[model samples]
Target: MTEATVAIALGTRPEIIKLSPVIRECERRDINYELIHTGQHYSDNLDQVFFDQLELPDPDHHLQVGSKSHGKQTGEMIAGIEDILLDVEPEVLLVQGDTNSVLAGAIAASKLDVALGHVEAGLRSFDREMPEETNRVLTDHVGDYLFAPTETSADYLRDEGIDDKRIHVTGNTVVDAVGRHRELAAEKSSVLDDLGVAVGEFALLTAHRAENVDERDRFAELLTGVARAASSLDLDVVYPIHPRAESRLNEFDLDVPDRIHLVEPQEYLDFLELERTARLIFTDSGGVQEEACILGVPCVTLRENTERPETVDVGANRLVGTDPQTIHDGALAMTNSTTDWENPFGDGTASEQIMATLRQTHSVRTIQ
Candidate 1:
């Protein structure tokens, strides 16, 4: 196979974390690739800190397309990516997860007849109301290669009429990321000590979904539940507030309980260490759910449905809606339960498998 020029498009902290291993693999093999940042998450905490901590190469191109309404944001991203795709003409375009960036990259690549690879593909929350669901579904359909994270995700693609030959079950890259950074996180992060919390003594909490935080009532219920659960367990809760959620809390005039400490977002290493050491986790973020499960920390999801059903199936997580009572009960149960449940996401070689498959399947082209 000849060498291929690849382009990876990503935005947001989770995408960077999950795609780090793949980027490193490209570097190690001396592959010609360009990293493009959509600026979907342009904040220092949400974006720049991750690259510094994960040691990823600086993005070759940054669109600086900050947050906007879904239609506008996605359209802008598609236009921005199309221009780059036209200029670079990479043999393949790779995108991960179900963000607007992923959807835009898929659309641009498909229109240009570039072979598109969708990592973390075929995850379905089955809730059309969720924007992420729509993005994942569309990207999966348009993709030339679907790198599913599990058998369940692969089955979802097959059911959607995607060719089996294009589907590869390469496990979640979260596993690869966690495996690579856990030890480094423990050594370097002092979030636990800084917060004055002992290992296995605090409950980590985070809620950032628009459905949960944009609505006053729902946000109130989630906050109440977190407080109730913390009070019941006699454990302090540490919440790294996402900017959106923080603004909503102020807009709604909702007050968090004293036991729930609201802090700014931590760097990747600090956040990873927090997840690894926490006694329990309550979150509305899918990436956090995966991280908690990978770290053997019991998780109570603040949403009614989850795309990562493997976490629930393996008994590592429970889905409790934003209802106060349900959230409280779910957290209580998870806190009291054992974390002996197996991790369904495979061992840390997912990046290796992804690169191998890409190399074998695509007609390699040079970087020039």
Candidate 2:
């Protein structure tokens, strides 16, 4: 607490969203920190929207690495991060979630002998085929402080040979951000008005997994399923299309149906508001699934499986897969199902819990 002593490393939108709550926590508690953005996603659309929507301070450094093969991109980030880290010389380098950016930053810090803190440390899809799974596992091994988002995540670390003393069940900061921003969502979102959606009268739809978008027919099938579900229920559906999904729609000649309002990508605040009013939501995003569960909206996951089984266990979500009939039936069942259930991700004190871990791990360590 003697000086601002943490550096946050991020690149993409998910890292931005998950880390924003941690940055805000530092600010609130008078913790000094520097934010470093590795430009793995350099598009202003991909990265800037999050900074603007979250109202984060301009990053102290941006690598501007842009797009490349994952190995090349991550290597570029490691070199750039090492340079900046050498200059700022913080007590701990903080990386969030499981992106190549986080992986690169952790590698940079480990080589430099800097203490490392990882936010959202223990999520796993058990699919090493995913670039993210590798990132998550590697980061956990090197982190001096690991802030796991759930007890499930903490248990994952324990099973993986992580010392229990180094891992803390801090809950997910997504819940912290959602809890903090719910009122702003109510005040700023016009999504409900634009779609003529009354309270509890609509479903929110989103689907952009690589499997759904990278394949032409699969992408069309996703939209088609949502369209069918919206029509069957006679409910207005608001879908804020992701760019990947939009590009595939054009490639596949998919139609945006009358009942399905294909809106622009929403900011974090508006997206939370949309989740709040949605009768049921459909998506393949793990973060959105967690958000919807925490916001008291029943969610139909548009994928074969979810990494966040805790939400399903708590009765807040169901995996509906890509079949149109399944999407429709799942949405209908969610609409009819009870939403009054406990949020297993804790009561939004993740930031405080994380700070406690950092305090215990940090001392007069040698500066980088």
Candidate 3:
């Protein structure tokens, strides 16, 4: 039997972290796979640090798309990816999450002979305002393989008319990532000491989503609410601010509360360590919601809605939005809640399942 060739395309830190397990699986099995990185996240803290910490191979193709208007960035990625797909012509092309990079890869592969596989499929915030919502919806429809992370997500795909044959309920890779990296993070990360905070003593904050940070009023409210919550809880708020959020904060001339300790973005292991040890976490990031749930940390989502509603259903998270009083109340409630909520993601084998499914399907296609 001929070795199946797989191409994995990713951009952004979350994609890198979520997809690292699959990349390692390919190496372990000695599968022929190409790593195509769309440089959607250009910052060293956001991009290179994850690859270094994850010990992933340098990308075979780096499309330096960087930051542009959504259309411009996706258009550039489509061109670059289409060129690579033509050259490598892999049997399957894999893209993870709802970034513009994922949409571009799906669009490129759909026009080619290669089968498209979307990892972390069928997530929906149902808010058309989010570009990610559009990306995920379009990618799921175009994908030949929809790797839904949970039954709820699988149901979302079913309701959208995706065939059951194509929808595989593989657990979310974030669960696998947290399980695989938790011990490593504990051993290597000194974020607690570096930040002068102890385990279970500080609340972690990550609010970078445009919906939360792009608007001056919203950004101010989110910061004020989180800081107030932290103050009420008698805990320091450690915010690892994203570059975009930092720019917006300065642009808006918003006053960060004295209690909110703003720091530069962290590497994956360091951030994972923080998440695992935090007393409570507040974030607008979908991936953070998943990680906090898997890590058994109480989370208060700063968004109005979440794609990962499973986190809320499992009692692992609360959607508090940016209202100061609500955020304070929600934070108090979550901080007092039990951290024993079962992880809704999976039992840490998503990568293996995803890879096995690809191999079996590719082989069947070959034989037919």
Candidate 4:
């Protein structure tokens, strides 16, 4: 077997979406990279569909860690990933975003001889309350390479006393993914027609963060607020509900408002189509916020704060906490706002830049 020169670790839909560009760049350059999937957030809809829709190659190793307590899950991932690293003996390991898989990969690679690269590094919600904040902070400190997505993120790393030499602002791969796939989504996705929603007529919603959905009252308030806002604008909310949030609704016996249309989790192209065509988007996801901004759609973030504050600074998104009245007002405010805000994320070349940086720093085998 050919020894892999680089290893990329990821375990969630967002990671898959954000890293697809990098994977494609690797393929385009004929880099010998092994893909390791931790299976941290695996489901056919959430996992397989993304790989299928994005035309990504299958992972070389899958550690079926599944769901567990944070410590248990991450610990299992570390052991499994370390074993793979030992066998593959890659020079560098790459992880993206602030998932448990990322943290585990960082810890595993840090312990081994491999250099660790954290993509979308230095993002801080600053809310220690968020598990992701802890994951990102720890991963950034241990990583040998910090590929920050924006200057704001780079500054955050500098403030944290990290060496500026290790930080490189490589725009965001989401912009690359969106640019690469939006046209494909438009041509291939019939989601709007299947959902019976017209272009520029419906609102898209996605709230699945533990902070938002684990609590019955908070989840109810979030849903109610979005429903009220959509109803006031005479628009139907098409929610591609996350499994966790859907389970909460059932467990809480929460009543979904008539104006809210709940659908199963959608494939990548379909979700991108929904975001591209929606008049507005309400989300608790950081990726969706960035995607909305990149796609030139107005967004109202369901959370009180965001790591991607550039979206707010550029008038692309509003960070309104889950209050029915406040959400309604925020929706109204964004509806009246223009979608012409400049994309704070970089032009669609982040993938190319990331690959070039890797080649410059590491002695990876590349096809001539």
Per-model CA lDDT versus the true structure: 0.90, 0.83, 0.91, 0.92
Clashes of each: 2, 1, 0, 0
| Candidate 1 lDDT, 1-368, residue by residue in tens | 22238999998889999999999988877789988999998494558879988988789999998988888989999999998888888889999999999999999999996899999998999999999999999999989889999999999999988899999999989899999999999999988889999999999998999999999998998988888988999999999998899999999999888889999888999999999998899999999999999999999999989999999998899999988888889888887788898888898888888888988988754334
What's the true lDDT of residue 239 in model 4? 89
Question: Candidates 2 and 3: which is better by TM-score?
Answer: 3
Which residue pairs does candidate 4 place in steric collision?
Answer: none
List runs of model 1 lying over 4 Å from the truth. 1-4, 42-46, 365-368
Model 2 Cα lDDT, one tens digit per residue, 1-368? 22337888999887888888888877876777888888876365647867887888988888888878888999999999988888877788989988899999999999986889898888887877767789999999999888988889999999999999888888888888888779877987786776667887888888877776888777766777888888888877888888777887888787777778888887777778888988888898888899999989999998887778899999999988888888888887887889898998877988878876676667623234
Q: On a 0 to 1 TM-score scale, where does candidate 4 land against the true structure?
A: 0.98
True lDDT of residue 89, candidate 4: 93
- Name the TM-score of candidate 2: 0.92
Error of 4 at 156 (Å): 0.4
Clashing pairs in 1: 3-365, 4-365
Q: Name the candidate that leads on TM-score.
A: 4
Comparing 2 with 4 on TM-score, the higher-scoring candidate is 4
- The lowest-lDDT stretch of 10 consecutive residues in candidate 3 is 359-368
lDDT of 4: 0.92
Q: Number of the top candidate by lDDT?
A: 4
Candidate 4, residue 149: lDDT: 94
